[model samples]
Target chain A: MLSSPGGNPHHPSTVAELGEFGLIRELTSRLDTTPSVHLGPGDDAAVVAAPDRRVVATTDILLEGRHFRRDWSTAYDVGRKAAAQNLADVAAMGAVPTALLLGLVVPAELPVNWPTELMDGIRDEARVAAAAVVGGDVTRGDVITVAITALGDLRDKAAVTRSGARAGDVVAVTGWLGWSAAGHAVLSRGFRSPRAFVEAHRRPEPPYHAGPAAAGLGATAMTDVSDGLIADLGHIAVASRVRIDVRSRQLDVPLQMSDIGQAVGVDPLQWVLTGGEDHAIVATFPRDRKLPARWRVIGEVLPPTGTPQVTVDGAPWDRAGGWDHFGPDQD
Target chain B: MLSSPGGNPHHPSTVAELGEFGLIRELTSRLDTTPSVHLGPGDDAAVVAAPDRRVVATTDILLEGRHFRRDWSTAYDVGRKAAAQNLADVAAMGAVPTALLLGLVVPAELPVNWPTELMDGIRDEARVAAAAVVGGDVTRGDVITVAITALGDLRDKAAVTRSGARAGDVVAVTGWLGWSAAGHAVLSRGFRSPRAFVEAHRRPEPPYHAGPAAAGLGATAMTDVSDGLIADLGHIAVASRVRIDVRSRQLDVPLQMSDIGQAVGVDPLQWVLTGGEDHAIVATFPRDRKLPARWRVIGEVLPPTGTPQVTVDGAPWDRAGGWDHFGPDQD
Candidate 1:
């Protein structure tokens, strides 16, 4: 049911020929909308309902090859990852994700189903987050890229931020760490993994409720472990102007795929210390507050010791460090 | 300061070699943050302050080649477009734009300056919108793609939406239309145009405040015209369950680039009728309300005809239809 140049084509030519304006026109032509939209498509901005007065938001983008190999992860995986990351942000804000809008660009030669699959992934993730895929824009590009924005409902709780951590706060984690990193190590080395580790690398199941739970429990500060534990914890440390010290003795708990580390002769502690992409919930609580289940107290926040840093047993745990989009060394 | 595989080693290898988890770790390891962040990177989600309790939000994405030409538009242009679209979305929502989060994916071969330029564009746009670029993520991919999320402040007004149109409401527009479409025509046909039309095609200037103005005026339903007027109006009609009728006679305003239309023998009416991307604000208002200075009453909302559609002089205006991402035909 595809039309080419000869027949009345259903879709326009490459967005290049349409140019940005024409492409936007062709794409948005038939969208039926309402007053709840306040502003629909064109304008310096759009307005929407924020009855609670505060909006919860987050964003994420997925790239081809690095995030998903065309041969390995389907467009659906890309879409799911894109949406999940943003939804996780909303959850991190101690909000319930309510809506999402996506931006997508792909090569013209790519199969049309590719985008549809991606949308399916987006829809699937939205369902998990209890959010709706409200709207989006699409265009042609050299490679596939998916950008997602997630809006969440805060339910009026005070937002938990990183700066609130005070001395004597306990640091805890709600999900596994380093599984994704270890999984990547196995994948790159061409080694196989048990289902759990591979799945960790593919679709991270974030503890969405932990953010609000921590907020409700009066968490002084909170964050997701998208980066390695040490690195991410360092963020909390720097933001709170505090020093964090983790005790490795507290980390030998049962894990979903701990054996994967053994298979590779890799130290599980290293994975937990430096692995990222697990999308787990980490937060600081006053010493007296009870933590939610699965959240293990692994460290404590102290007044900054001249320099803000995260360490293991009072010493900086040396590792390759964390991710940076444009590091000084990045080309 | 570039890292290279050989030679002076400018940047490093492609992201695939570093792997997804590793890259993320490296990217996030060194970011400095503030206390308001309640939650920093690495968690189920990040928590930021929304002291006012009400929040505004919008999202948009840009693809390589489709929205921009690597040969023509710089990465900065791509970033600008991305930020502009989302900021426009926020304005459409009748909110004051505030903060932005970006997501980017590109081939490792991309120059580092490309992303820097993109950030410059984002920062510049944020400055124009009085917003801040707070956080973002980057990954390696085959093509460059940018996704931007914009957050806004409602400043205490109820969100204006598209579904509020009622019978006897006046239909009005706040920005120019068809210029971008006309500009696209000229660019596609390889015809040089007056600089205005070309510029309109390259970078659209959406009327930022028309959204909040409509909200202030108690406009019932609203939407930005990313799609053509008729198509986007159709959205309001469907959502509001009302029929919208526009009088073309009312739309015969002076077009700065009408010469371009005459030069190409293309009906300027076609551009006005179906062209998109001139992100104007269109809203339906009570007949008694005073119209804003920039807005022109173009039509009226009425009881739905069996078929929901826009009409000119009681008949459907035949023209090239608006854009559809997955429509069966292609031009």
Candidate 2:
């Protein structure tokens, strides 16, 4: 068993009481794995089956107080959110996630149950996309930080990149948008009755299958909505050298969210157009193509406008650059 | 481009001044890629070819104050050390390193030159192992934390796990041992005259070719010596259900190291046997095997004695469990 700096192994409650190896055992034992894991934990490295001959990989780091709030999110909620973000990135590349590895830094005085529950959430989240927890590393740090790297398989299909969109293509998205932001507004006011939005902020349900499905249906370009719709679509516009115009009327702003925005004296459309972390999958298809019911048409591609790359109703969204994860961002 | 919170982007000296996208561009542009990386950066995920149908992966996290001190090492040295630690784990699995992904957390006020130079170090180190920097994520945090995940190809060979060693096997090792520890001791004393030793502490040169070579030579078991030798071998013994005995007489303590030991009133042998972080390779082979000149025989496997799984010259090493990464570890 691995020793803890000053922990008593027999007590086995908090990290300082249980020791290091016990923490590992508690966290790893809670993992639910998939068949692609050729070698699990307990080795210098993990071996994962990659049948497609190529692996798709991405990584994300989440820090407490910045990416999440301990008072607002449980360990389980944080874990699911962490895995969902990176796994959604893999899916955005038109691949199916197969494995996840984690690098965690925990405060030694924290309760061991926190990490065990966190892994439980990670395991369950991975199972949603048929992926497995293969390996990870844990160490002591001043604050709690989780770094996740996800690997995926393309399954013989060419990856759909962000730079493939062409003028005259139509833009669409599958999965919830602005719900997390609306939830944050609700929680910011100290009200939790609208549990749906709060829960959405805590655990995002990404449409993982939509990515490869979009690729199969001949998607021209794709990206995940981690950075708001206009901003993310702006990336596509810049990379593809085209202009993107979103019809604000086409966006779906639920009554509850609208009510929350009204109560807070903010525009609900602002949240729908901007706000991040919902992990929604957005893509562009040929103008003549038929889209599935799950995809909501929101915008269209056009020849580049000299000044603005992304616009709403052929004009800039007045506050487009006013708020984002990049500007004194707290959530 | 991603906006900075409050600094002027045009001034671009610190992370706060350069903005997020500028940071990404600076770091990604410095990378030297390999042919196996079908898609490198600038995407939702990276695609790497895995010809062996199985991918070997490992991850490690290095915190600034705990794993490295800015005053003691440069960002480049920290980057090299972080990459080396994870890459060595992949090598221990009898695989050739192929790609590396990173998750970094940096303070916004930190200089922009730090991460750019850090990427240079990572890129050069990956080049040494014939690997590429494929993808990564960076975000703002209160403290600096680097998390690296390395992927490798096995080339159709089965993995050599720790449980494969048997009694009557000869133990051997390749690469520098205790050099980092001696260097650490030198630096701890506030003296920097021993340039070679201090450099070893800053940058470890892992034998990239030794692992696969040992596998081809029919090595029964293998692992990288990241933990102290006896501590890491103890893991092997427990997993393989055997006993291991090391010969202290066989160890070669350089004259300079012994002289440093004498001046510090410490035994150089202690550093050779118990010091960690000079990422050397240690493996077990059958007694009849003919090894290459690079491999040095140092011990032998024997039946389990139950109380002490690993010993030095037929008895306990004297202070096996008293010192390790798990107990009051500073370096």
Candidate 3:
């Protein structure tokens, strides 16, 4: 916990004591510059080079209790997860990320170190995607919220939108699928032995490069698996006006996830098919196109019969929910 | 007030009932596209044309109770104010608005119409600047937080930053100054009559066009008066390594603001000098350069002093505070 144990007498402990200007300086000074940034932080707005002529943009918000619990995850973990989510969205569009802007709301009395560490996390994760922290606004609020907007450049390539999938497309995905949900299950049960799963839940390792690579390979459609495999694929299905069917056998659930699922009296397939927040890169490519070793074929796109949808083993998965933000609140 | 009057029993009145996809469709359908938007909302990411080969981006967050009061202002007003604040930052960079992205966190039980109306407000305001609603995310949280990211195109011109001010430049401003502070003074007192001032408090009308015009007119440095004239100018002074001194005699305060200030037993000049959130354009131009009639010269920039700062007449303004987000909270 970075929430001040009250040790230092000379240094400011909380954000309020540091003041807005002082906090801005403390946060900005910690970040290094990136090539995409023309004018970085400390300006009215950041100028990011978008040589592609078009900029890909996406935004996501993580509320303290809703998306993450401070008691369960450190501020740094939250920051990394936040950046990964938005960057993944940009990558899903087959755009290489250029810059990220943060809109953060925190309690005035929050430990100054918490936000500073959070900034470090955002910067580090953005660096992973070769993006820079351009600019952001910090305001005082009762609820802690981190809202990130990531901008990307397509580099003369057309963005791979959800509507581009065709009937003869084969669906493939890279990166972890059930790991985050398995981790969440472990955390909820008050056990943390599966460090990998728990870490995935805390900070998602999105396959940022895979997106543009898939685009280069002529992917028809692409999306990040943020809201479960089926739910997000349903977005592609609806947008592309196609039907997608996933083969559960093709999904490789790690032995650890199965063990955790067995311990919890739940099926590991549920996590693989319906879990959210893993941020795996999923794309649809023409059936004749050869996919790389990293891309694993798991499904196929078909002509829309009735309403465009997703199915498991050629049937609608009975469990239909997938991290619907407004569905229900456990807290 | 859109919170169900318990009428229209068949209609889904709350966001929880509306669900995520339905709410998104409802919101996205209301927005019209703009030329800058290569691909609008409803995708993995929106593609915006950044014709200048550089994209200018800025973000801001507005929390429910901290930045706005639901009882005092409608969701539409909150949306407009939210969009205006971010758009003003883009304009402050001498960038013409291109697109806006929203990251909204709302209570599950919030009126469904609230967010929709908020979207309407955002769309209308973006239209005012010829920008489109490109992309966004929505999630449920205890507190309502609207985080907006606005992008702009510089149109092949250099971004006019705060650090460009020169020692021999004269400071000038366009748009309303201190109007929002005076309006806030009205609302805080529980008196909502003086409708124009109250409306200004609800929705600020920023001089977005003046920003690009200033850049074309050879302005040395510029910023929007979002943090009071002195405080924002203080930013310019610090960034430009110069001192700015404002002559109060040259500032013109409306008669209504004076009446309200007198009624509240406060000085209106204090509102004009120290108030924030009018979002007026303020810039410094070479002393010999001619500015169009819209810009009124109010001060001059001088060599760096003991501390590069803004002064009232020739000395520091005693009441130095602006709209410091992390400062003391009124709510």
Q: Sorted on TM-score, highest at the top, how do the candidates line up? A: 2, 3, 1
How good is the docking of model 1, as DockQ?
Answer: 0.32
| Number of the candidate with higher TM-score, 1 or 2 | 2
| Residue clash pairs of candidate 2 | none
**Model 3 residue pairs with clashes:** none
Evaluated at residue A95, the lDDT of candidate 1 is: 76
DockQ of each: 0.32, 0.81, 0.81
Cα deviation in Å at residue B160, candidate 3? 0.7
The number of clashing residue pairs in model 1 is 84
Candidate 2 lDDT at B241 equals 96
Model 2 lDDT tens row, B47-89: 9999998899999888999899999999899888888988889
Interface RMSD of each: 3.7, 0.7, 0.7
Candidate 1 per-residue lDDT, tens place, B1-331, comes to: 2222223244445555455554455444423343334444444444444444555666667666556777645656666667777787778777767677777775666555566566776777767776666666677776666777777776677777778899899899888788777777777667666667767766677787778778888989887877788888888888788999998888854565567666766667777766777777788999999886789999998888867468876778766444322221101
User: Model 3, stretches more than 4 Å misplaced?
Assistant: A1-7, A320-331, B1-9, B320-331
Interface RMSD (Cα, Å) for model 1: 3.7
User: What's model 1's TM-score?
Assistant: 0.76
lDDT of 2 at A285: 96
